[model samples]
Target: MGRQRKIQRMAAYRRRRAARVFRGLKRRLGWALLGIFLIFQILAQLFYPSYLTLPLARYNREPYGLKHRDDMVMMEQSKFVSTRLELTGSYGKEQVDLIKLGGRLDESANFNNLSYYPKKWRWVPFSILFWRPDVLTLPITFDDKPLLNYTLNYSKKHSKKATDASISIRDGNISIKDGKKGLSVDANKLRLAIKNKYIDTSGIVRLDVPEASIEPSASSADLLHVRQQAEDIISKHIVVSVAGRQEEFIPSKEQLASWLRVVEESGKVKLDVDSQVFGDFIDAMDKLVAKPAGQTIVSVVDDREVLRQEGVTGERVNRLDFEQKMSSILFRPGVYKYISIDLEPIMPEVKTSYSFSHTQAGLQAKLREIGRRYDTRISLQQLNGEGWGASYRGTESIPSASTYKLYIALRLFDEIKSGRLNWQSSVLGTTVDGCFHQMIVVSTNQCAEEWIRQFGRTALNSFLYERGISQATTFTAEGAIRTSSDDLLRTIIGINDGSLAGGYERDKLLDMMGRQIWRQGIPSGTQGWTANKVGFLWDYVHDTGIVHHPKGVYAISIMTKGANYGIIAKITRELEAQMYP
Candidate 1:
């Protein structure tokens, strides 16, 4: 028992000793860790910022907020947890970060400075965590006007004023000083180039600055009057013999002005009337006394022209005798001149022929054939000339994908023309022009939906029907916006033929359609240019266009089910061959 007690005591003492050693080891480890931590904090504070930044400048490192165009870009400014130490503050930290920037600008831009640049001193914070946000604005702006304004300002600053051609009159002689063309920053081109160059998602204030010739106020052509030619010595009076009767007449300024003209001939100014002009004067005098002859309307039967009725020939003042006598009187500076006159019989003509050769039978046959062969619904029309166009199930309504945007375009056009809306008039947040272009060229759905909502699809449909722009076409389709090939042709013909939109507005739509990016359909098939709007959804594919063929302009609308653009192109080629042939 004593031995057991002694063994227990020895074990207890050893246990106590082991516990103390372990405690000492743990204490030493804690101190060592504390020292390492202090060193790291010192180093971190030395290089990185100690305080937090404001709302904007946290780029690239542990970004807490959104980093997008117009939106503030967030990032940790490569700051240490404790930058209060003397060793803190990277000399060119922002520049270093910029050099180490991993992001890129827009694809169109090539900003070399973005990739690498000399380091600059970082902003000394007025207060810790109060550094200005490294907020580089996006080159792409939602308003798209800031850069535009900048470009305008830049152009104004750089544009040189043009010197107009100087005119001087001295000693009865006029001379001209050639105008000088001044240098001007082409603001439009500069805007485009800068936009393209800085598109790299790079910061907004990039200085990659990049049209036109500035014509002087007057060019050489404008100074044509500057060349001096001696004025004609006005004669006071002249004598003329009319039918063997002699008479004396005085000259007047009006008569002289009418008879004489100044001309630059062979490097000399000759203030005189030429032979052709004299003859013209005689003809004009004759017209004052002559009566136009009655013309017989002719009829063309079987390619043969026959006079339906006879008409009397009219008499005109015979200019031959008078022209011979008074030919040189005006240019010779004689005042008033009398000449012999006579009458003669003259014949007039009226032209008549049939023009439009509408391919009603042939186009109908071809459209029918195409529809049967393709095993899909089709619609086609020839919208150029006088005859009613041919079609295959063209009146039947079908789903319209992007093609439905045509109605929006047409309606928008009407609104703008009627002063209901203007080019800058807002539709959904964008300008009328902007939405129109986006709806037509880009074939975007959001803008179209917005337009329909704003303009009321029902009202638009009513307008289409009332204006005869479309008979059966509708804006709100049951399953999809419904349209007929004929209806589509009607709008296209309206644009191309001036039956719908007229003047500049018509040209704008046509131009946009011609340049629209989607061209895999009829445009690809036809040799000539095709201004078209295309649509596709699910198994439906369609193209509507006005094609300018060498023979004539014609409109074509092709809609299909379970088909692709290749098929549409094939159909276009077939129709082209048929119609043109």
Candidate 2:
């Protein structure tokens, strides 16, 4: 029994001890759990503040399935941080830090999270302990689709395309286009803007995207310089004028504009004029301003006197020199006061003149002098009616000799004109015209006799009488004829002036006379066309015909008795000299 009581006492002591230990342990465990709950609550209030939130009844309604409530709630709560925001763009992204957006970092959250508390609540202790509190207000809201679309549209509207530099010429003008700067959307800036919209929570949701600017290859100043150069060229003018003349050719402004041109040289614009156009202008001026040299005349025979006028020369515009001067003045920049081109003198190659002096009295004196020297009875006359008349026994009748053939030729042509004889009619197996040519040109006696026999002496005498020559009788007195200088000179004048029969007949007779085989007397000293017939009967020599001179045609007849043929030739030469010289 004593042993049982001792064991029971020990058991009682053990139970009391056990009970006390249990009580101590239970109190310690309760304190430990409360401490742990407080710790978890602090952590939740700081890092995981959203974990304390309860869904709103409206949000929990069926078909109101709100997705990402925590993220949306965080975005909405962050809006209370600031009222303004600053946006920046870089590398195609939009960037906005909390500080730049007028917000602060959550220090309680170890700066790993942005603070969305309002300005008044910033000093409130443990303000993060509440989620969706009434004091918290969202100052800004962001819609991703609207924000993205807005950025894209803004980029599209404001974007610029780069332009290439160019240079061109049009209508004698120069045009230049400088390279342009391009603009594009900054994608980095847009991305930054989106990020800030969710994280910064600035009251202003407006996004500003920076544009990238691309510069041009060429500058505007370079293009302007080219345009100014063209303007200067068109405004300038060039004047062309003669040295001493009042006439001047000034190109109009419009014409100058047409003539002006622009060219590119070494990558630079240069002002120039059309060479072909300028050359043509110079040529036209040359034609108008040039003067040709002229010949000088003094007298017909004196070349030395003609040489005296050699100092007189002409002038012309220098085309090449003028072009050079124009180019010098026109291409450069300045006003040209005057451009003078002097005329150049020219020398003549040959000298010539025409002048003479001789009187009819001198011819008469020479004739009388020759008459006295030769002791010949010379009868002479000039039937031009402008000088001395018939002189020195001109009325004295003389044997016509072969000169009677002249009267016969006159009658034959008259018959031909009267149609009594045809020029081609065969007369004794010879053409009448042929026989006439032989009779006149060769002075054939047979041809003359044939014409006389055919036309008859009565017809010849009648023709002479009608011509106011009563002394001429053909084939009478044993086939001999007689005439005076007056009658022969009258007949020659009639033949020369084309009044004997007709112009054709007269020219025919004159042509035959010109080709006379006997050309010693009148043709010897004459310088031009002459027609004459000479008669010689032993000592009797007679020469008479019309002599063509520069002054006029004149009929001269000289019947000489016992005169040398040389004396007659001398007399004829003196007469021609007086008329022509």
Candidate 3:
């Protein structure tokens, strides 16, 4: 058994050796075949480049067809490809083929004007690398007139090579035998420059016609008539021409056409007719401006529909109507002044609305009676939402006067509520020559200054801004005290309605305002409820306040420019009496 085992081991070893040798021979044969394939590929590219391709598309270094015609031929294939396109042309059996293959031809080519190129051709490249094709452009003309000129910047490629680049356009001419020409462009003055880029060319084509002939024709009389008609049409226009060195005016097309016609007829010319003819036209227009255009209402209202009639057109409004309807609250009829009254708060629950009766004729009779007594013009108004007196001669932009102090007081109260300032905190008072009196007792200007200083001008202005009052248009900066009876009413109502932020209690502010001492202008017999303050100045007696009675708290203010104290007082009283009762 031991001898048999030794012989089997030797046999197995011999078989393993033979198997290793066979495996080695098979691997060597595979490697030799691969090397031979690579060598053949390199030789093919070096000897016949047309058969080669980029590595990405090549399947073992084989040629790949091009994807797009516009794609340039690969440099390796360029030498084997043709690059030019061919064109052929025929005119009445006369034919020509043109080869197109240059940078200049490509730059100026446009397919739209192929009619100009009475030639055509098919491009075919023999060499594999000649894959890119070029285009051909031909010059175009109309009746021997060169209509356009195009340029190709490929001058670098061909120093003196010319690209046929041009355009032609024509409109049938109207022939007039034995007729003088009206205008003609001068060929010598025609300028044309061919730039490489469209941006390099001038956008406007200027035609210079220095001379034109005009002669009477059989229809010349009719033409003259038409020209005269056109001139008349032009003359009717109000030519607003600016006659100065500065370019101040712009003329309309019709105006410019008129001037151009004149320049054509007469040799004198002006580049800008507006600057030349303005003075004459302005002089004529000024005369028409002097008289009012009937009457125009410049005032604007929130609801424009109020000024319009249901069917009939409303007549234009004038200053007189406006003053009577609008400014009546500010002053007496046909005047500018200030009117104010002391309006003390009545009991909130008082019954002031009595039925309209002839008993003393309500508030109207009271106003006439007071007007007779005071000897002053008085006009009462229902500003908030109540009625008292007759609608007066002025509208309601009344001087605010001391009543404006109420606004300051309201602001102070607001500051206290907001924790911005303490009620006990004191500010230095400013003593004006003649304005407000002390803080609460005497209506002194010093007190007004002190309140204004504490609040700060900026804060005051900001407050007014919040209220939508134009900063440029204000009554007083010091203490920012300015009030209109109407506005005061609106403001108080806003406060009551919580429109104004951090508003003061109505009773508290009204009580403080009534404490104001300048109450000499209060109109008697004009009773309703009144909660406001009055102010006085040299030659000015003003009172703006809110009248709160049982009917409703109506705000009323009266102002007069030129009137005796008694006269002004009477007018305000009458206005109030008429409005309230």
Candidate 4:
């Protein structure tokens, strides 16, 4: 009980001491408040009761405490701001990047360098009308030395849209020369030109650094010189390429020039560019003005005159103005238009001459090898016109194939020449499967069979004998027909020489044979222009014709067994090419 009483007495004594300590603290706080009020009153008296008269430096590092500045705030001195900026631009699906630096300038050193900062070397909370949160503070260094009161601003662009940007300076405010303007940069342009010494406001570039940031002194100049050297080294070392447009690594001269021009022009100075890049710029311009690659053509001519017009416009008299002409006269049908005929010339460039006899031998060999190459058989013969022929066994007498039609055509001509028939007396067209059309158009089996019965087999046999063709030549079976190249060439000679018939019958017969539409066997642009008859079966082929070249007309007969139509055409076409070319 005694111990409890003592503990209570001690606890009461501690409570009284705590109360006294609180009273002392209250008295000190009142005195401190009075001192602060007295100091403000003294400051007001010293400045003549006006806040604007206070030195700007006195407000340094102090918050405004919700106070506002008047509209007539004096500009004792301006501050200089420096920056390093970057830009980029896009072309098609490509992007370009560029970099630029600010220039240096001397400023007025006597100006006040003081400002209210939220924290040590941090951005101050200064807003005019509305809040802009993207603003941030930055430290700018020129020639490895930091500058004061310099704020950097950036403008970014992409896909033709521009975004607003601002920057803060870490060092509060410092004195600078008057009439200095800060640079605004667009950060997203690929190419740049800084040729102008002065800034260009209306031009399209990404980055712009003001001239005041760069200094032309010993250390500062050395710093800039090093940067230029580094840039040159980078340009030489770097290789750029755009896919689909170029396979090799190459830089664009125009792109680099654009960048340099912007700066040089801003400063009223000139910039030097690499010669290779200059060449590339010139080449690009040349290509822009050039025509594209495609087909071109002239007109078709016959007898040294424009006979048939195709793929051409304007008057027929304009034929002489063109250097060359093209026609669908060849079997390969299409527009056949081109700039240079060398690509489609019937005769390609040759280094040496070839013999006519050698050409004939090659043609015969090609015909024999046709089936192996093109799955077709073909034959070609060069007759002496004196009735002599060099023949390979399978190519000489491959039956008439369809060549017998030439014989029937000749017979009609013979009758007309004898005054036994008229040129336009229409004969009844016999109807049968494949025969009527074949006789008139293609000369198939049905037509030949029926025609033989009407003409009488004996009379046709006698007709052959009189033409100087071999007695072995005959129309035997329904479709069996036979003739050697030797006999066929003789027939062509007789027709051309006027020995086949006389008068109107001769004219009608040649016209009928000329219009035969067997265009499959012969290709155009041979050693000479030819009027001929061509015949083909499933595996047999023959061409008997007369060629009228610059020299004279000569008889030719080509026959093949076990050959395809494509092979025959190719061989003869090549033969024509080889002989003429």
After the best TM-score superposition of candidate 2, give how far the Cα of residue 342 lies from its true spot, in angstroms.
97
Provide the lDDT at 331 for model 3: 20
Task: Single out the weakest 10-residue window by summed lDDT for candidate 2.
Answer: 56-65
**What would you estimate as the lDDT of candidate 2?**
0.58
Q: Please identify model 1 stretches exceeding 4 Å from their true place.
A: 1-359, 383-388, 469-471
TM-score of each: 0.39, 0.36, 0.30, 0.32
> What are the per-residue Cα lDDT tens digits for candidate 1 across 262-333?
444576534444456556655665455566887767664323454465556877656566555554554454
Error of 4 at 485 (Å): 2.6
By TM-score rank, best first, the candidates go 1, 2, 4, 3
Worst 10 residues of 1 by lDDT: 81-90
Report clashes for each candidate as comma-separated counts.
24, 15, 72, 55
Q: Candidate 2 at 176: error in angstroms? A: 99
Say what the RMSD of model 4 is. 44.9
lDDT of each: 0.58, 0.58, 0.37, 0.41
Q: Model 3, 328-422: lDDT tens per residue?
A: 33222222322221112222221122233333245554544443444323444454453434323223443444455656665666766778766
- Residue 118 C-alpha lDDT in model 3: 12
Better of 2 and 4 by lDDT: 2
**lDDT at position 431, candidate 3:** 24
Q: Which is superior by lDDT, 1 or 4?
A: 1
